[model samples]
Target chain A: MFRDITIGQYLPGESFIHRLDPRTKILSVLFFMVGIFGLKHLYSYLFVLALTLTVILVARIPLGYLLKGLKPIFIILIFTVGLHLFLTPGQILVEIGPLSITLEGIMKASFMALRLIFLVLFASLLTLTTAPMSLTDGLEKLLAPFAKVGLPAHELAMMMSIALRFIPTLIDETDKIMKAQKARGADFESGNIWQRAKSMIPILVPLFVSAFRRADELAMAMEARCYRGSEGRTRMKQLVYRKTDLIVTLGMGSAMVAAFFFL
Target chain B: MIKIDNVIHTYKKHSDEEVQALCGISLDIQEGEFLVIIGHNGSGKSTLAKHLNTLLIPSEGQVLIDGLDSTDPDMVWNIRSRVGMVFQNPDNQLIATTVEDDVAFGCENLGIESGEIRARVDDALATVGMAGFGNKEPHYLSGGQKQRVAIAGVIAMRPKYLVLDEPTAMLDPRGRQEVMETIHRLNKEEGLTIVHITHYMEEASQADRVVVMEDGKIVAQGCPREIFSQVKLLKSLRMDVPPMTELASILNEAGLEVDKTLLTVEEMVDALC
Candidate 1:
């Protein structure tokens, strides 16, 4: 089931948004985040919410799946809302001894919560649509200007791409090791906290050893195939922004402007 | 072609108990030959195979792959490019999500142009009979298929020689057969030199020549029949002969006139009848 957590979490589709360049997608998501935070009123918030729903609809990603991706951070989301409600000082609307609720507190809670939710949704949209390799290429291109300052932009991108590539592999390896250990009567469930933690030792040691060995072998394999850093490297699939990318940028930019006036 | 002259390899040098992986090895491998090295655990066979690809340099002496010294820093890339290696675990060797990307990895690393890399990737995948499954994720493949993809990765580099280190050691029977057959085809049809290191006696029996190792030394080197015929010597080194050869030896002890050169079960039955 852990394999379901695809490294980039990209959902393949032929939708207009999905077909846009990853660089365009990334920039659109960044603008969406900025728009969400720029909201100064309930009308602006409403516009952002509507845009979120429209994008999700066009992308055709199941709302349930998007919510599932957010499951890990439910506690954090709740904490943010609760902290805002309790900490923001204003004309007290309700009081329970040390805890007071105000209109500004409620407003701030809604703002912060909506900001985070839309932020995650938009970012997940980028990942769900763009292939990991394309995302890395877009990132490298975006960061290419920084190479002049000794940033090692290409190497960094290569590392990210390789890491993304190995995520599923390592997960599969972990699954195999777990099954192997389980066959040998290694208890991984129905134990206290410490016992459960201790059970991971067998899994951890072998995984760590195998990871190191794989890294060594991979280095040798890379060298064998003549990998000499990112210099002089050309990709089979180059990232190129198209007319659709420009349209999407304009669409998101218009939405941001609309939100400034409407909400 | 490869030339190993007095190669000596040791691990944990200057330790109380140092491991001499290869004591002293001297051999010449011809182009387009299938050479198999068989040995028990910790017999230095894997270390020897790694030398051909320049994965490990000799502690002493020399390993020349197509006249490029393995120890020479400048020649390391040249040697490695000519001698590609495939390891035991397919998972460790695969660096891409899709089969096509995995095969392209080797070519891409070689700095080949996009068009050339794509052509080579398709050719390599087709060579291993995985053309249709190029877009599929590696996890979706069977064990044999994954190993074939690993082979395709090496093939994409278009190396003159392939050094496989116990590639089927972790595969099932079906997977082993798939990999061995592919190696056979690569050696026979493509005329690519192969240095296959494995512990399975049956797998080694298919090679043009067999080299057996024990305690960092090559104890035996000859045609498979000649090498496997010495059952007593192989047993003394804790290595096994093919099942048919063992059966022949047993029948010989029982006063049967069956030849000891038989390797496969079918051949043994023919000789016995």
Candidate 2:
């Protein structure tokens, strides 16, 4: 069941968006998300939505796969929309027995929902286009200036990339452990909420132990490989910006500027 | 040459119940030699291998690699770079997502230039016969392939000595054979000195010299023929000889004219025919 979750997953492609520098994609997504929130008019939101759609089109990711990522957030989206619909005090449009829906509430809820949808899509697009390793590299490069202020940018990047790399591995290990526990007559389903959470102890204990063991062994291996706190370490694949990155950054900048001025 | 002089390693030395892992082990590993250390569990073989790469300093004596002391604070990185190590668990050792990136890890740690690192990475991958697999994810590779990638990672550092602690212990027979062949090729063609620690007697049979440890001390050390010939001593030490060696020894004791020193099946077949 955990396999169906598509967040933090990368889909490899040869599209223009995929070929762009990871920094470019990351900055574009950030700018787009901020611009999406700055828009006060429906026309600007529509423009942002169109821009997101164009990026998805250029990325060539299947629309079905992209929508599949939203499955888990469906309930949260509905709750937000519902909360906005009932709470916003405005001119009533539709009346229920006790609760009344108003024009302002409908408009506010739809806009908020659209913003949420666009936020998820833009973030997912960045991950979908760039590999996690390059994403961490981009983050490290962007944060390098902060190193003078006692920030451990390299270590942070390394930790993030390692965590990303181990997600699938840990998931597979969890699945194996769950099956092993199930074979021993452990039931994770068909129980009360507290009972189910309690039953997870058997799985959690071994998973934590194995993770600690792996971490220890990995630390030893890293030390044996001459890793001394990432000092003077050079990467094999250096991140460099291309003309395409400049073009995309400029285009995104102008779009955000346009949203700020006209909206 | 690597030298171990009166080396003694103990775990939890400050505790009241100190366990001595290695007790006064003195040995010299010659340059370009394929040396295999065989022992049962808790026999200090792995502890000794870690000493070679300075992963663990000795509690008593010292390990000198090319005249550089292993315990010296300043020479720690130098020792590690000179003696690369491949651990048992490939998954734990492989830190990168892709094969090529993992191979380049050691060089990157060494602060090599990107152009030189690329050339070294490609060369090391080709050395391990993992060419054209640069873009492949390590998790998707087979056990043997991942181990080879680990070896390639060590090779990229251009270390003079390669120390592997039961690299094939977690692999299937085919994977074992693949890793062994890679190690052998690297030793023969590249002239890299190897210090392999394993429990597999068959793997020990192929080494240029074998050292058998029983209780944190070397019980026997000699060529394969000389070591496997003493079947009774090995049996008393709770270690197994190669299957052919055991069979030949059993046959010799059964009033048959067979050489107990035969370590391979082909040699037994020829002797019997």
Top model number, TM-score: 2
TM-score of chain A of each: 0.88, 0.95
CAPRI classification of candidate 1? medium
In model 1, the Cα lDDT at residue B137 comes to 76
**True contact recovery of candidate 2:** 0.72
lDDT of each: 0.84, 0.90
User: Candidate 2's residue-wise lDDT over A1-263, tens digit each?
Assistant: 57885656889889999888988988898888777877888767778777888989999999888888887789999999999998899999989988999999998999999999988988988998888788988999878899999899999989988887677778888999999999999999978999999999999999999999999999999899998866879989988899989999999988877777788
Model 1 residue A189 lDDT score: 91
| Model 2 lDDT tens row, B38-121 | 999989899999999888999999899999998899999999999999999888898887888889988999999999999999
CAPRI quality of model 2: high
State the lDDT of candidate 1 residue by residue for A179-257, as single tens digits.
Answer: 9999999999978999999999999999899889988887766766667877556666666788878888898887777
lDDT of 2: 0.90
* Chain B TM-score, candidates in order: 0.94, 0.95
